[model samples]
Target: MNSLENFSKWLQEEGRSSGTIKTYLQIESFQKWWVAEKIADRFEPEEVTVLDLQDYKQFLVQHARNKRGGRLAAATVNKLLQVIRTYFKFLIETGVISYNPALKIKNQKIQKSHNTVRWLEDKEKIRLLRKINNPEGMKNTWHYKRNKAMVYTFLMGGLRVSELAGLIIPDLGLAKRRLTVHNGKGGKERDIPINDDLFQALSEWMEIRKESPDEIVFLSQKKGKFTLQGIEHVISKLGEQLGLEDFTPHVLRHTFCHDLIIKGYALQVVAELAGHEDLNTTRIYTMPGERETKKAVNSLSMGDSF
Candidate 1:
């Protein structure tokens, strides 16, 4: 096998999720750039230097344009740099490199205008659930139940879209009132307690769901496992009915985190439930929403008595 194939096997052995492995293998783009720039006569792992990485960073910032014809975002550049660092780390471990030259390099700073977490307000949540419960426009009762179960899993479980997609039959511990996320991001596993609503929805779906030969939890209408795009498309179509813009499963996830934090759940507890690798990510939920901020300011106003 080639070095890239070897690296992929190593990553799998290390329990990295498939998504992470795919992203890490994107180093091929860097290899192409290395050849195009004539950094080396050919792309050799041993010839890589910190200077070359620095030049590449400069290229990303000053020259690279995304598919939309805009400069690569700071976060995107940092993610690519992280991939480069990981590649070198693998090389060092395998004795192909003496050290990782990208060690001292820092990522570009990202500025925040406001909290980027978008979640449904209580009213929006109620409306969404009502639509799902009634689904008057939906003639297929089986799909309605399946979609409801999926949405509840997102809104209550705080599961990443990929994690939900990876769920299998045995992952649901209905009687125990919790579900196991065995293939979470970075391959970390965790259990999230199933609330009354989620449990009911899931139980109902399970009653009618046709058994998958692969033991998949959420099968598509065609009796195959649902693709990531298929899952997102299902949720997006629901959003359209509610007149919600860009309402994806991620919004439900954010709502799950935001609801728990605002209800006074401990930060550490929330972080673990959400499988957030960084506590700082969960802390974003603590930032008040626009409506909450407005309410806070309005509370100080003395009405007509003034």
Candidate 2:
């Protein structure tokens, strides 16, 4: 067996996820290609050269074919390079390789365009909320109340879909009007504040929750916990019925941040409220719309408009 096979075995022994192991194996394939085509033999711990590394990178860009039979994209090639770099670092740390040849290869920088944040405008938000609350035909439907509570939690509390789904009776602090979210991303916990609107919605939903106290807060009609896909289907169906575009849970999150920013909340406060670990991650949610940009520019004094 080659070093790649040994590394795969080691990764499995270390309890790495299948996805991670698969990505590492893809990197190992690139290394095998380097040995077969560029170096004329397997790279020993300390015998690989920077020139050989550069040749492998060129092969990734000019010759590598994706599963779709297309040339590898710059982004995909960059990801492969990152995987290779990480593997070499791991090999060095484990004393399997004395020198990290992959480190000598520079990654191709891919420029990112400003992504358009999807959010509901204020009027659209109000309209959607009212529509969900007062569903004309469905007077006593479970979907009506459930969707209303879901939208309320997202807009008012800024809870992610996962956090909302994972909620339990113990997570709610009725007196304080707060929710304790456990095991958020990165295994972090946070208490998010709730307003009267959200409190009322939760109270209404609680009247209908027939499960035990330890059961999940949100449940489907089948009395099972609502999955991410289920929530997505609800949002999409509602969006279509209401003639709205691109309505998803993430769009609701964007609306939460956009509403907060427009109401003059500081970026740091918004970041904390959104449960983001980094302020930079939250900054993406604060992109101003046309009206906001106009207001900002109009407020600036340009010294007699030179």
Candidate 3:
């Protein structure tokens, strides 16, 4: 069997979704590099080694061109490396290779500031809520109410847009004021409790949302299941309306975790709520906002403050 087919079977056996399998397959730069560099004279999995993986990482940094006419972003490069790492791990398990050479290859370092993620300031959040509560047009439309609930879920529940899109009717635990995120990153599932405001918003939206044949909780303009991009665009529009610069799903999620940390929530709690597999991932959200950072510096008396 071909390598792709073999990898596909292994990923499926490991419970990766079909979409994930397709994405992994598309991350083909490593194979291209192996062939082009004459590392093995031909693309053979068993013959690959750590030195080859190391060289390919350098190639990605210096030679790879992104679609926008720039070097690959650190995050993108790291994602590609992750795919290579996983593929080699699969090969090792299958005995295709004696050992996994990609195991020790380090990912590219990405500065959190370079990520361009920002959350709403307290005033901005208040302004957004006020706008949701007092819409000038459509005082009674489901679309307006649905958007309000969605926005609250993103901020308060710290849900990713893809997770929100995957929700079903049963995922909402209204009586208990919690929602089950069944499609979190890496297919991990977690339950997050809703704040009173979010509970009320969701409750009101559910009352107005027209029932459809599909079990999906969120719906699009045509009443079909909501798509991931649709949720992103909704937040983008809200950001534009609120004068939030470069607003997106990650920003809302980061804002959620940031607010929690500043409010004295424990790291473990925040990590669980955010559905982060690693506390290190959650720690990135703790990076201080400009206002908070400035306040911290000012709070410390300068040297020789007798």
Candidate 4:
């Protein structure tokens, strides 16, 4: 009944994020298995059984190590499961699936034992910038300058890698202390303010940003468009070299949002600047640390020691 296409259409109509829609449609891995199992021939959604889903889950755990050289993480598996469950739920509501087979599937519990901030601290950020500016431990070359600018923009601007990659010179508002982010997550446009630090970095970069046929703000060594993967690779290598192993562009984004909250900025203001779809997402960054909570509780006055 072409349910997949119909489901995709529904997602688009519901204003789902482009990333979510894309992931749902990229179900080729599941489809390949279905085809080999002979279930791809005019498969009826209502005809599926719980046992069928169980078998597929097992197959994922057993044979899907080809990608990561190990079984997929529970979080990854759960994401795929959520998409299938939602698809079937949609089918049932639309009179496609008379019964839902994925109803019993449970989401995996994510381990949060680390309980550490996902973003960089102010001092670590300074170290990060220092490393990017002179990776060779000497002489800031042209590439080092560009690397510093790119990293600073992600940290201060809080842009998604894709958004950064798509940026052009025309989106800048250097004179006004902000930049217009075009085609961000969920196809939303946002204006993000840049502080004096970020402004100085960009000023240096613009001198060598180099006028060319490509209007993209960032460029690669090959004279082609900058790519998400390329930017990630640069950040990853810089982080490792600077002794901050898990650093990433998104970490910089998280740090940007976190710093705003710590600096006494209103939650709504941070939400708007970060372009979060929900205020609840912004609230997550404000969660008190264990140490902070302990200190608060201990501040109470006890009149007499028992």
Candidate 5:
């Protein structure tokens, strides 16, 4: 078999998802084309050269087409390059190659625009909560309560959807006003403080949650664990009812950060509370909009004012 087959087996052994493996295989197809068209038959792994990589880079830039019949995006090409580089590194480590040819390949720089954080305004938040509490909503009474609790947890604790979904009965410490998040992103565990609002919501939810301690904290109508898709669906439905645009769970997280920033909490403190390993990741949420910027500028004046 070829190197791609061997690398696919290695990725599987390393517990990579099938989707990831398939992406890698697609990248490998590009490399195989380079081998067939440019490199001679004797060009084995050890015999691969930097010139071969340069030729491959030219091919990618000039002729690479995605499945959509358009030129491959810079991001996709970059990912493909990363996969090849990783494969070359593995080959070097395993003594299959003396030098890593893929190391010298320079990826195209793709300019990324800053994403404005979508957060609920104070008025919008109040309106949403009021709508949830209204008794006249057509149906899905249990869903309203469950989703209210979900949004409350997100707003109060800044919990990621995955982290919230992974929560169990033991994770919640009502007495101490804390919850232990297990294996969050990058397998990091941290303690999140629970406020009175979240605690009260939890208390209310617990009356129903007591039926299954082994199950997730959030349950479906069938009393099973709440899937991520289910949580998203609830958010979408609520957004439609409230006439709000893009009201995902992540917006609740942004609201948590925005409220804290407005309350004059330090960025470092917010970052810790948000379970962000990098402070820069938390900084994105704290970015002020044009209105705040104009207000700040208006607050300043020349010292020579009569």
Candidate 6:
């Protein structure tokens, strides 16, 4: 019926997940911004021009501020541009526009550094695992168990947060000592082995978890499925308690990959386990991180010689 409605249908037919569709539809904000800028009385896809897109890209780079009033990351800007480009493509396919105006715009370059991939150091991992493993004085035993299993799944299994949230009862193949990620990134499916530690943690949670008809692997005390934010909140609270700054699902995932690389696991093996489509993504772990760099520098320290 409407442009957005048609776009939604198109995205669904393209097999994009609901989350991805929602993200792509965030182009409404850009449309509103365009109208507010007095570029046109009303935002229309067919009327948009490449110069308008360039101006908008410049605005995003120079003016866009996140919720915290900080400049948006290059990746965030590029994601927005991607949404715009896709929406324009949709318009062209539907015969609403003659051409995709946003096509030629290039994404901002993202500099990769060793520090970019944040993972837990040995001591930090030990501290976090120790506390979660044997949480002393924690009153809510149910929450502790569920949260511990979540932490272990991230740390040991290398699952993305979305995959963890999407996990169902059938996905946990305890008999085979592995967990199936049925809905991994890009709808790919993979199985991660359930080592003794992860198996024990998951089993402990399963014993006390509330029964839900949805068969969700993890459930809230209210018998509802955990949302992405809900899962992050649980982990965030744990991070606060442990004094681990920026402790997140991705950090745990990085730690898993990094640890595997450090242990001499093949890049292909780590990529498959982590569901990474690219070996280059896995190879970043092979680079010397801050700890290794510090160790090398400290070895030549004048104070150490004295």
TM for candidate 6 is 0.85
**True-structure lDDT of candidate 1:** 0.89
Clashing pairs in 1: none
Q: How far is candidate 1 from the true structure (C-alpha RMSD, Å)?
A: 2.2
Q: Per-residue CA lDDT of candidate 3, range 261-304, in tens?
A: 88989899999999887897778767777766777888896766
Q: Compose the digit string of candidate 2's lDDT tens values, residues 1-306.
A: 777787778777766655567777887676567667655656654666677778778888988899999988777887788777767776887788787878778887655432456778777787788787786799666667777888888888888887888888789887899889884654567888988999988887777675445378788767788888898888888888778888888888888887888888999999888888778667765676655677789889797889
Candidate achieving higher TM-score, 1 or 5: 1
Q: What tens digits encode model 5's per-residue C-alpha lDDT throughout 193-279? A: 989888887877777557664658889777788888988888888889889988999888888988998898999999888888778
- Model 3 local distance difference test score: 0.84
What tens-digit string does per-residue lDDT give for candidate 6 at 1-306?
877888889988877778788999899988998898765788877777888899999999999999999998988998899999889989888888888888899998877788888899999999998998886798999888899999999999999989999899899999899899987765678989999999999999888874547689888667788888888888888899989999888999999999999999999999999999779789899998798899998898698566
Candidate 1 residue 152 C-alpha distance from true site, Å: 0.4
Candidate 3 deviant stretches above 4 angstroms: 39-42, 112-115, 294-306
Q: What RMSD does model 2 have?
A: 5.8
**Backbone Cα, N, C clashes tallied per candidate:** 0, 0, 0, 0, 0, 0
Best by TM-score: 1
For model 1, give the 10-residue run with minimal summed lDDT.
108-117
TM-score of each candidate? Answer: 0.91, 0.68, 0.90, 0.70, 0.69, 0.85
Clashing pairs in 5: none
- Candidate 6 clashing pairs? none
Model 2, C-alpha of 268: deviation from truth (Å): 2.1
In candidate 1 the C-alpha lDDT for residue 271 amounts to 95
Worst 10 residues of 2 by lDDT: 109-118
Deviation in angstroms for 6 in model 4? 5.5
lDDT of 6 at 277: 79
Which runs in model 6 stand beyond 4 Å of their true positions? 36-38, 135-141, 186-188, 210-214, 266-269, 276-284, 304-306
**How do the residues 53-115 of candidate 1 rate in per-residue lDDT, one tens digit apiece?**
999999999899999999998989999999998888899998988868889878988775334
Model 3's TM-score against the true structure? 0.90
